[model samples]
Target: MSNEKRPYKGGHGKPGHAGKPGNGKFSQGNSNQGSGQGEGGAKRKRRRRSGSGAGVNEQNRQQSQNSQRTQNQRSQGRPQKWDDNSRGDKKRFENRGENRNDSRAESRTGRRFDGLTSVERAARRAKTEHDDTKRGGGGTSQRNKSGHERNRRSMSAREFSAAAPSARSRTADTARATVFEVLRSVAESDAYANLVLPKAIRSHRLDHRDAGFATELTYGTLRHQGTYDAILRHCVDRPLEKVGTTTLIVLRMGVHQLLNMRVPAHAALNQSVSLAREKIGAGPASFINAVLRRVSERTPDEWYELIIEDAKDDTERMALLASHPAWIVRSMRQALVAHGRPATEIEQLLEADNLAPVVNLVALPGLGSLDEAREQGAVDGELVEGSALYASGDLARLESVREGTVRAQDAGSQLVARALAAAPLDGTDTAWLDLCAGPGGKAALLGAIGVQRGASLVANEAAPHRAQLVESSMRPLPEDSYTVLTGDGRQIRETLRKNASALPGSIEPGQLFDRVMVDVPCSGLGALRRRPEARWRKSPRDIAELLPLQRQLLDAAIEATRPGGVIAYVTCSPHAAETQNIVAEVLESGAVSLLDSAAALREVALHTEGANGESVSVLAGEKDPGHTPEIKVKKGAPAVKAAENPTTAQLWPHVHGTDAMFLALLRKN
Candidate 1:
């Protein structure tokens, strides 16, 4: 198969010019090895270059040293992209997360999403609405030697001219010489992964393979940061806290390559160390090398065993291996366990997150049927039964995607929409509303499906600019099938239902959608991999801050649907407060009725009796009919399955091989 046979996708050990390793000033055998400072003739050259007389030229030498250090501030990488020198060394490592002013024992908060194995993760979450501090990197030099060293250090103008910048510096490991830097910047500054990675890769001019490598490296380093830091601490001599930010990140990049990456240990070490010596200065290189070598001495198993030995329980073990913080693992484990998953599944869930996600695309329903799109060159069809094609390449690169005939939607989102519109259709246009449709991935798919099945869709969005996205989402469909409106959907619904209100509604009676999709905006915790920087950017507190907004959005969605209309409450989060609690509150309010998804998906899969042996999230029968997603369940399943529901809450890249999405289908009584 081209996927496996593709030359570029080869793993480590496949033939390539993997570079040489360990490039320090002094080492064995190589011609240039052991040829620099501290070697036999070095003191004589220093004295000779020191020059017999010291005066104006001596003062000139001091200024020169300061100038060279300052010039590096504007190197080609992200922390500072363009170079305009004659400043202090403080400008170079600004994004390194190692600010001298910041507290060394700063509060550890951004780690709550690590997917731990207990409910403690939830109750432990505190609000992160505190003083936000930007990273002040590169204010000091790595070679300052002493922590008490001055923030700005420069000698007089009489210093030496021969003291030039190191020769080992080059572009970078990515297609673009500066992609890694860009990645670090996004993580430190923007906290946007989807926005940055592609831009960096494209700018670097790397092919698909190299782009993949850069992408993996960026995310992997972020994901396993805790473990990497431990290994890095083992390798570097000085306290890592004292290390300059830029150099520390460089070491982190190197450590990732050494431990988890497939790149040969030598290539990883040499290139990284060389970059370090030049970027950071001399002393750190040998220190970096010593640390890396010691870390490399252990196999992955040995490392896992060692790290996990410290974990006293399943939560700790899963957190360590899966690269999640204990709190996150604990919270998710609770939500998942209620959905019938085991605690051990937490590790598997985390591992799955680190793997590259298969791209999924939805064939816009009315614009092009899945079958028609497959015929039009959508490859990898029929991989997952309901899914037509496994998205490859930049789906956005396809004119079809740009033209809005197909969209890059997670299958989980597809299923959520499907579950919302899943009921037996009575061959006439049923009004459907996709509330909050912006940059419209799901809205477009919903529009397409609604169009195909004799239904009309009203896409309501909060932002006018984003409302255009709703229009763009429906661009491929026929004009009469949908309309895009900008307004708070909840208010719009209330006005329509009000007895004495003069508020204009986007639609009149009979125009109300039979199904409403509230793909409510949440903390977006589910999309960590694609959004590498989000890991560093999010605090456990972001969740609580979003609760009110989530509640309002859910209320809006609930109000928009007509009686007997289905409403699909969806979020990328599997969080209980966001998922079940939201729905449970609605149930308590007695506004609408919960409908059985099994009945909605009766055309797809469900089983009441155990006709064969199979494991379902909730298999409540003696005869398990060995159900699959493809099997159409013909019996009853409730919208709310009490504590005994068979939903895995639709986890991603794990169960459906897509993003984690929660789905609850409710029908108005």
Candidate 2:
């Protein structure tokens, strides 16, 4: 060899001779050793050799030989010295060939091998690996653990139900289920518990005892929801809003049973947790269990003290303690003072709102009798005539109730309707009107009384559905005794004026009613005891919104009455704006004058004694001799004597055990 290196010839070593396996360098060929060329000539010769078919065939042969050698070494259980490098080179050659085929296939089909795109392939591979890991086929211990966690997280509904509390744990009580369904309906669909509860009780076929239990549980839970939420906030780790609604309702029921009812702590906890697991999920059930455990650590009184400890004032403290909104507390206090009641009674009133009201029933005066109800252990009402207090069970069991001869009516409502019927009117008092009489509890009583007085009643409701209810309520009475009209109460005067001849009754054309009952729509703050959830639903804005309509309806009532006719303005609320203020504004028109409503209520209460001769005294202020004078003024010349208490009557839940119904009797002048 010359001092300068000769240009390389193409081959591993000499033509047709393989290089020594461990040399790590190719052998030089003798074909162009003497006729030497420069580097350029060597490059051109190498390119030509690489592009030739012989070179490709040689590469394939070398790869096959390497694979065969490796296989033979593995089969014979002998380690090959040069196995790593040879195997790697062979794999690279195979991969390159595969890449070319893959490129062509993808270009033609727009997909990779296995008929899947890249994204699809990735997803399929991941799923396959997950399945393998789940089956304990091939994965690390960490991956297997993660797979188990995922499986647990994605458990089916049936599996979760199976994992719930045992069936033998007294968790499937029908009464509790009924209560839960009612609460869920109220929370989810904004349905009234009074409307949904009875139907649910019927559908569940609950007995009298179970019905009573369900009633108490549902009302107690709703009444104390605010207080329970306060206590739950103390027990829970996060805000209550973050909790699921169904879970929160379950917790509320549980708390009510624990603190308010006679239920044992263990029973309450297990039943509530069971309900959660049954209705909600196992995870939420666990959360409820943990929280309820924390709640059971303290007594209800202790929780009350702790929760009210941070109150900024008496109103807020009472709001938390009595389970009422703070604004409602303040409004109640204002209402007490405005309605001639002492402001100190707000606490009693709020506590009363939490108490479940008794089902008050009224027998339609002449056409209905209380014999059926009395035979079934019903006691006479203490607030109004022809009314009874039913505490036994579902009122549906009473034949009179089913016959519409006796209907469920609040005592306050009975008092107002009776007062309106008893109100003195000049000339013939034979024609009456019950404006805004929907779902006709009052209308039924008034119509029955009217039939006895030889009077015809026209019950008007704004909604067609409610008008039907009014008609249904009066079905027990003679069909000719009352007529149900579906129309706006505000337009009653005009409608009558336009169609006076078409009116149903022994009335002359263009004749107005002798008595008109404007039991106007109101915020229903007065009936909170009967509708516990209403406390949370109402706001001051609701009263404000109803003001104009109330005034209009009252005005219409006055206009629709004869000059000497009596108009009874009634509301199931004691809010000043909805009651006294509305009466005052309508009175300012000088078309009507306020009468002694308190005296009328007292008269009605006196004539209507309970079966045991007990009666509720509805008189307040100086009108009531038992009233202790809270404010005393020295006999002086220039003192305004507490603006001589308005003659309007207001029934109180705490005082009379009736809804805080407001009544203002007016006479068209």
Question: Highest TM-score, which number?
Answer: 2
Q: Write the per-residue lDDT of candidate 2 for residues 1-669, one digit (tens) a residue.
A: 222234434433225322323344444544344333557657755775676745865775686687677689889999765756586665665687788788988898886647577799888876676566445344223323335422223224332433323332435578888898899889878889999999999999998888889999999999999999999999976589867677788899999998999999999998887787667665567668889999999998899999998999998999999999999999889888887779998888898898888888888877778888788888887656677877777888877788898888888889889989887667989888999999999888888888887888888899998889888998898877777887899999666666565566676666788999999999999888878899888888888889999998988888889887899999998887787777766655566667777777887774434568875453533334121112332343233322234377888889888898888888777
Error of 1 at 257 (Å): 1.8
Clashing pairs in 2: 13-27
lDDT of 2: 0.78
Residue 145 miss distance in model 2 (angstroms)? 26
Clashes of each: 45, 1
The per-residue C-alpha lDDT of model 2 at residue 70 equals: 69
- TM-score for candidate 1, residues paired by index: 0.64
Q: After superposition, how far is residue 354 of candidate 2 from its true place, in Å?
A: 1.3
Instruction: State the C-alpha lDDT per candidate.
Output: 0.57, 0.78
